[model samples]
Target: MTQFASLLLLKTVLLSGLALWLSVVVVNNLTAFRGGVFSVGSMMAMQLFDQAPAISTPLLSRRVTSEGWHRLVYGFVVIVEIVVALLLVYAALASLGAFLGYADATAAIGYANLALAGFVAMGLIMLVGGAWFAYYIRQEGAQITHFALIGLGLAAGLVINIPTP
Candidate 1:
């Protein structure tokens, strides 16, 4: 195969890997529903930073202590995860088809654009949610992870959009 074909294959593999990761996330969230909810609830409630000597601010007042709201937010997160996973899976398959000469690059890139957009949207949603609840104060690791995801999604989007020679 030529270099261009190799690049196409690489793009497909990357997209597939991302899709697989998202699938695992959805499965883990569903399988450990209570645990996932607890984690989110803990962040929302600012459990870790409530009395910590670290930067104390009135932002703690924004904490969501209601269990019902926790569950609702967790449900919404899962739904978005599922939707993004499906889009990525479809994009990966289309990319594979393009690589294998069964489809054109335009179709693959179109699906990839949609999938990558979803992926970045997920990252943005997490960033906004975490910021709203002041997760960055004590949950810097999670914030970093979300930023990394957004960066990877943006990089992959650029790769997928590169014109073929």
Candidate 2:
């Protein structure tokens, strides 16, 4: 196969991997809906801050105690995940089509860009939400995971956009 074809295959694989990752996340969230809601509620309620009362007391005002809001946020997150996953799957298919000469590389690249943008946007939303709830203060693992996902999305974008000289 030509180098261009190789690049397209690589792009397709990357997009498919991202789609699979998000799809699994969606399934997990749906299968454990209550658990997901509980996680969101804990973050919004700033429950972790209770362990550090000295620093947390003043920031307690940021807590969102409403169960309704927790469910809403979790629902929104799941919806976004589903949409992004679909986009990624579509983009991957477009890349594969381009490789097979059924579609142009430009179209595949455009779809990939859109999918990556959505992926990064979702990560940013979660990161910002976590920050608002002071998740970094105690939930170090969650913050790291969000940052890692954002990095992966960006890295994939770079990999797929390399010049095809």
Find the candidate with the highest lDDT and give its number.
1
Give lDDT tens digits, candidate 2, residues 1-165.
899889888888889999998999999999999999999999999887767454635677889999999999999999999999999999999999998999988889999999999999999999999988888888989999999989998999998798665
- Indicate the TM-score of model 1: 0.96
Q: What value does the lDDT take at residue 121 in candidate 1?
A: 97
Give a tens-digit lDDT track for model 1, residues 1-165: 898898899889999999999999999999998898899999999998856575677998888999999999999999999999999999999999999999987989899999999999999999999999989889999999999999999999999888877
Error of 2 at 33 (Å): 0.9
Distance (Å) between predicted and true CA of 51, model 2?
A: 2.8
- Candidate 2 C-alpha error for residue 57, in Å: 3.6
